[model samples]
Target: MDEKTCRFLPAWDPVLRFLHWWNAAAMTAMAATGIIFMVCGPDLPEGTEDALVSIHASVGFLFGAGVLARIIWLFIGTETARWTDMLPISAHHRKVFADTVRFYLRGFRGETPLYLAHNSFAGPVYLGFFVLAAVQVASGSSMLGLPEEIRSKSMAQELHATVFLLLLLYIIAHLVAVFIHEIAEKRGIVSAMIHGKKTFTDDERDSILEAHPLAQKGDFDERKD
Candidate 1:
């Protein structure tokens, strides 16, 4: 569609976009190194395993810092990027969440709820991801800091591995959901993350303008600035 005719809304701020990508890259690196450490460390030449472990630890620290920055941004970010936006606290939000669930349960047959940012149903899942990441950091740090004898006896390693597996599953599910949204809804789900804007259909724009006038205005102002 032509720019003059199409309605584009700012969905993610630059900082949010940066965090999304930074975290994605860091997580992917950590996952790769972690898997190699777990699966190939035993067979690798001497010192290689230790190097991998060191690399994983360094990446894990960076990822932890990114997570902390994200948490801070949750409070300072734009309306759609705030923690409140991801939570279904209001009745309207809950209803939309239910509708979103129904949209998927019915095999994408019905109208999907349009969101300027994340869908209501995804808020809880995002929260769960944050919690899972925190757990991973904690478990990993605990294991890394423990003495060799204590490390062998402690459950931190097991907890760390378990959380990493869960994180892998979460990443896979997240990718699948992104593809589903891209193919089924044609929402530019992936591009939105990269470019920080979401182009809405005429109907979607109208719905958002009517329901969230202030939010629309703020988005427009931010884009103009």
Candidate 2:
């Protein structure tokens, strides 16, 4: 942790961070409302079901918009935020990905590969999340357009329910993964999403710079530098 051996870098852009928290809040609201309906069933008071549905639908729209914006950002955002970073298209990326898998397989022990933005192993997992988000949006939208009686038994409703379950599982897995990484790497990953910076050792910094010569560096903090 010597200042001379570690550095802080700007890893996430402002727009990307905003969308991340925006979707998080929206998803939390949607999940809360959805869980209430699942637990309450038909035993709820008079207009409670209708009120919950309205809240869920409103949150769904925000979540859908956030997902769409993120998809677009993957193409037009910063070098670290683009599809290039998300996919193992290059040799360096593929190598890092393999090392990452090995690290996880070994129970988060040993040397995990360093990444300035999304973890190479997590990139594809995130891609899957986006795909699920798209499906959820489509299914929910279709259900919204259907008649109440038909909506309950429709294919869209079934898909929506199934995807919601998958999403819950995904959330649990994502949190576990993040917890492991934060403990193992001690890289300020959780804070990176909020403040757009990550800490790296001097050797790690050099390796990343070699791989990404143009990687953006954040303003130096004398205490951290």
Candidate 3:
């Protein structure tokens, strides 16, 4: 491929990328503390459990704030980052969603549809994750507010645990998918999240730009002819 035929395109904005990694770190910390709590149970020293709980709560609060920031960005960010971009509201997008699913089902061996932002199928899943996170936050808050006598008996802890488990599974699946894409498509999916840019061939860039005109707003159109 000629050097001119490939160019770097802005994918994630700086704020969005920062929030992504911030939430990732927060969640990782929360997960680690949670696992320790689960494994140590009541056998640990007197203050160990309380200390773990404190760390978990602190990271959880940060994660919740990050989620809120992301939700606000959905409404105020660029077209690629907006809710409309992710949702399959049009017939064309719905068709693309179906095709993307079919491509995945076929073992992801071939070129799947290229999307400048999140794929049509992934939009709904991302939305679902947000909802789940909100629920987990609410339940955790409720658990913390309850009196000690009732806290253990309250359903909030169970609900929070369930949502956390679901979120963990989602995170695992998401990481696996990214890994597969890195190996199969080699589109720099992970690096794009880190550096806020993606490399694309001329044909790929043309197709993406045709589908998402707003993507050309930033450095996307800075390519040499």
Candidate 4:
């Protein structure tokens, strides 16, 4: 086993990356279109306004579809991407989990737990983001689920507004989490998400508590970079 392959390894598979980027793109398009529909509503007529709304509904449906696909993939995916990879699922690992989070609380100080999957606590952060995003998408689509024959403009507007606010807040929190981890953890966690590489010191190998990224790999010793 390569000594360099420690916890928190780059375990995001190609399919996971595909779903993430695709969902992001669809969501962006939906937000932009929804914004235009809202801002231009003042001058729009009953017919044109209705058409714009239908488009928004379509976008929401697509977003929901992507979310569903990702959720399913999460279950059937590789061991690294599976739901179990996010937490210390076994009862025996509880205290080790505590110590791992304590290490983060201490700036990943000293040798952290060698994680074969995700760090004991960091798992929750990722899971929280998924839950929040799913909720926002679902709530946003509820308005569309209402009958078009009795469509309520005000209600639709409110749903869009609420979803946007929650989405904005969640995204802000996500960025802040990434920044905090990178600065405090010294692991380049965010960059690893984007580029699939993390900088690790000798101490990092000892302290990491993830499974896939932290698990032993064969090529690390020969690769200088």
TM-score of 1: 0.90
Q: Of the candidates shown, which would achieve the greatest lDDT relative to the real structure?
A: 2
Candidate numbers, best lDDT first, in rank order: 2, 1, 3, 4
| Candidate 2 C-alpha lDDT tens digits along 67-164 | 99999999999877887887777767888899898997888899877877877778988989999998998899878857778988799988998999
**Of candidates 3 and 1, the better by lDDT:** 1
* Tens digits of lDDT, candidate 4, 123-218: 766676567667767666666657655455656546657757667676677666557656665666655656555656554544443333324432
lDDT of 3 at 6: 64
lDDT of each: 0.79, 0.84, 0.79, 0.62
Query: Which residue runs does candidate 1 get wrong by more than 4 Å?
Result: 1-4, 145-149, 213-225
- lDDT score, candidate 3: 0.79
lDDT for model 4 comes to: 0.62
Q: Residue 118: error of model 2 in Å?
A: 1.4
* Candidate 3 lDDT by residue in tens digits, 26-55: 889988988887788668786987788888
Q: In model 2, where do residues sit more than 4 Å from their true spots?
A: 213-224
**Ten-residue segment with the worst summed lDDT in candidate 1?**
216-225
> Candidate 1 residues 17-114, lDDT tens each?
99888989999999999988788866988688778878889989889988888888889877777788887775556766887889899997767767
**Which window of ten consecutive residues has the lowest lDDT sum in model 4?**
216-225
Q: Best candidate per TM-score, number?
A: 2
Give TM per candidate: 0.90, 0.92, 0.91, 0.64
Task: Give the root-mean-square deviation of each candidate in angstroms.
Answer: 2.7, 2.4, 2.2, 5.4
